[model samples]
Target: MLSVRSKAVASALVVFAATPVSFASAGGFGDLGLGNTDWQVGGFVFVAPKYEGAKEYEVRGAPFIAPTGLDNGTSRVQFRGPDDLRFRVLEFSGFEAGPLVGWRFDRDDNDAARLRGLGDVDGGVVAGGYVAYRGGPVTPFVSYHHQVSGDDTGGLIRFGAEARAPLASGIFVLATLGASYADDEYMDAYFSVTPGQSAASVAGLAVYDAEAGIKDVYFGLTTDVPLSDVWTLKLSGRYSRLVGDASDSPIVEDENQFFGGLGLSYRFNID
Candidate 1:
């Protein structure tokens, strides 16, 4: 027989051990799966900069719902974040692969007061797929998405790993590290500045045509604390560094960006 605290610790370990790790990329949720076949609902408040390089920060709220379990024959539906919604179409032998679709917010000059003349990047729907393998305490995954409708017509590819380790009573820590690659169209849309555009903007701003390459590398840490049988609290922090063409873009003010958030979730099991 296990005590309440012991049970809580065991449950936390199972959840982290069974799920795929995700990094904080556009339209990405760090940890998600049908593990334990339980439904979860939660909301979070986070502080993030307006754009990759901007100095201003904005506090925003997001809601999430995971409505499927990780049973062998069960399907999964999840809303991981504002820009990440996915459905698992296939599941077998510890492997889950599915279609992912989501919306991306436009980056307007107004997003950051200092970007008034940099122009706006239109938001649109992205469609893609993700394949993940969960074995023991290590999960490795890959995902790709293309801008199906928007001003940007490129795609993105991401690969990452997630690992978990128990710390103390009912507490666990999860860490994620990943890298992202962007296509030429996507890179140019966000990082490029045309000669005409440069002339219309501040001095020393050069016309740059960004080519496709590794855009950023990111890492994140999440602390999970089980409060009760059905409730859990999570605290997370992430840092991303712009690299290659993205880092060289004159419009970019800060090459590194940070984000932090906290959330509480409730789980409901359906039998």
Candidate 2:
């Protein structure tokens, strides 16, 4: 069995893989008018339990960078953490859509001692497209990604909605609810235990064949505070629940996971 700390680390990695960091758009309310182009660079630290059922916790640090309104305010781009990146191809009348790309981190024995003999899951590239409609205070979005290079083949679909509101002076709250659907290839790569894997299992885990289905549902909240004209601080928390075959996998220790992080960044604007 995996230790609590190991499980926390794995869970944290999953959170990192699934979520993308984002900053508020320019000319929203403060009206700093920094320029037509806006960008931010910073770093954040987060804590999460390894996987699902592990009792231990893991702490990790990641850099954040997001640049928007690059093409004379017609294009937007963002480097959302280490695992996810996105670019908006066009924006018009509250509708923005574009290409999305990301990398899946590898899972190996180093992640958990209990994973020994299970063989490594090599990281791969994910390519997809997303469409989002920002009408009023609510935004709904959906995306489809295919594994172009990695141990996992097939693809997954992600759909979600987000909303934001002001809490107080210089403070704003953002919330998101989302879920993902995984194909057989993607589910098997992460959750399935093959006969060979069961035979070599050090933890005596039973063979599990994960099927394609709804993988997990997640909810997250983020709060942003502007420390000054050029600096901002962000705090965030999230919860996820595994469902369907993913939760039934013998390798899954817990079905519920939690994550939290804090970040500070310096903003720049170009005219």
| Among all candidates shown, the one with the greatest lDDT | 2
Count of backbone collisions in candidate 1: 3
User: Could you tell me the lDDT of residue 163 within candidate 1?
Assistant: 72
RMSD of 1: 10.1
| Least accurate 10 contiguous residues by lDDT in model 1 | 1-10
What are the models' TM-scores?
0.73, 0.76
Per-residue lDDT for 6 in model 2? Answer: 28
As a TM-score, model 2 comes out at 0.76
- Residue lDDT tens for model 2, 1-271: 2233323333344433333333334335333323437776776677765544333556766665564211122225443322335567667788988787776555665555566677887767778888888777788988888768867667888889877677886566667799989899978887888999989988877888999999999898876677888787767788889899988887766788887877777888765
Best TM-score among the predictions, by candidate number: 2
How much is 269 displaced in model 1, in angstroms? 8.5
**lDDT of candidate 1 at residue 21, scale 0 to 100:** 25
